[model samples]
Target: MMYISRRERFSAAHKLWNYEFSDEKNIEIYDKCANANFHGHNYELIVTLRGEIDKSTGYVFDLKKLSEILNQRVINKLDHKNLNLDVDFLKDLIPTAENIAFAIWNEIEAELKTANCQLHKIKLIETENNFVEYYGQMQS
Candidate 1:
């Protein structure tokens, strides 16, 4: 099997909200992350796919297809938007780097299936200091 990866970037903002906690409690627990005013991150995303190269094309998967899928599923929804106010998925879930990475993996997984490829992993860098990785496998 061969592995290939593509990278993309976007900027967005969000605040973590937990309905189970009072606004005050949420603020105390999440600190700046609970700010109603929101905070932004210049997010960098890396998507990896693994599969056997098609002998006819000499490629594991078509780069054009990957670019189109990433653009349609991730870039369009996240670029220059506020995750707290603009994305439906974040309406109910925290928009932390981990959650965002998982969401991206889920979104792109379906699209990749159509091309006979698997969404292997997503690495999301929320900042130079913080990032998350989602590999579509359960670790023991």
Candidate 2:
């Protein structure tokens, strides 16, 4: 088996909200992030795939297929959109980089099944200082 990876980028905005808390309480808890005004990030996404390379192509997976899947599913939905208001997943869940990473992983995983590939990991970089990773396994 061989592993292959691809990277892409998009910009989006979101806010964190907790329903259990009062509007004012959530605002105080999340501060700027809780603001209705929202904030944006230039997100970098890395997707890794693992599978046996095809003998004819000598590749674990086709880069064009991977890029197309990402562009069609992830980048199209997320790029230049307001995550909190525009994305169904983020409508309830906080749009933190961590949650966003998991959502992206789920989206890509669904597409990968049809392509005969396994998703290895998803890395989301919210900024130079903040990043998150989802490897699709429970840590012992």
Candidate 3:
């Protein structure tokens, strides 16, 4: 199988605070990420797909189409938005890098399927020192 990847960037803000926990506990658990005023990241997202090249087009999947899909499904929602308050898909979900990667996969998986592409991985770089990689969970 051939693999292709697309990279996109978005800036978003979030605070890793759980309402169920006290402020001290949240701070203890999340450290700097639990800042009350929120923090922002200029995130880099890498989406990878696996498929055989279409003989007629000589492409695994059209890169332009993949970019469009990403823009519509992920980047548009995330760019300049607040992951804690401004995003629909992220509502009630912690905006950690790991969770964001999983959320992005959910956001784009169906569209990729329709194009006969298997989503191979999602890599979310939240900072130079922090990132997450998610491969969708397998069904039993």
Candidate 4:
């Protein structure tokens, strides 16, 4: 089996505070990330797909097709937007990099089925110091 990965980027804003927490507690736990004004990041995402190469196409999955999916389904919604407010999938969900990475996985998992490839992994980089990687729940 072979795995192909795509890199994409978006800029978005979010605040890490939970409304259920007291203001002081939110500040204590989330530090400056809980700021009422929110904050933005140049988020980097790496999406990987796993499958055997098609005999006819000689590709595990086409990069052009994957790019379209990432652009239309993910980037168009996330780029230059507010993750806490502007993203529909994230409504009432925290916009931390971990959550965002999972959300992106969920958003695109079904679509990838058409190409006979599995959504293999997601690596989300929120900053130079912070990133998260999630391998899907199974492997083949």
Clashes of each: 0, 0, 0, 0
Q: Model-by-model lDDT, in order? A: 0.84, 0.85, 0.91, 0.90
lDDT of 3 at 42: 98
Segments in model 2 whose C-alpha atoms lie over 4 Å from true places: 114-116
Stretch of 10 with least lDDT, candidate 3: 109-118
lDDT of 2 by residue, 96-138 (tens): 8888988888777877863546888898999999899889867
Quick one: best TM-score, which candidate? 3
User: What does candidate 4 score in Cα RMSD to the true structure?
Assistant: 1.6
Q: Report the C-alpha lDDT of model 1 over 31-98, residue by residue, as the tens digit.
A: 99888788888989999998877778888788887988899888989999999779765556778887
Question: Tens digit of lDDT per residue, candidate 3, span 77-125?
Answer: 9999989999999998989898889888999998888355689999999
Model 4 per-residue lDDT tens digits across residues 67-99:
999999999999999898899988888788888
Cα RMSD of all models vs. native, in order, equals: 2.0, 2.2, 1.2, 1.6
Instruction: Sort the predicted structures by lDDT, highest score first.
Output: 3, 4, 2, 1
Error of 3 at 134 (Å): 0.6
In model 4, which runs have C-alpha deviations exceeding 4 angstroms?
Answer: 138-140
Q: Alpha-carbon error at 69 in model 2, in Å?
A: 0.4
Task: Please give the distance, in angstroms, between residue 12's alpha carbon in candidate 1 and its true position after superposition.
Answer: 0.4
C-alpha TM-scores of all predictions:
0.90, 0.88, 0.96, 0.95
Model 3: CA > 4 A from native: 114-116
Q: Could you tell me the TM-score of candidate 2?
A: 0.88
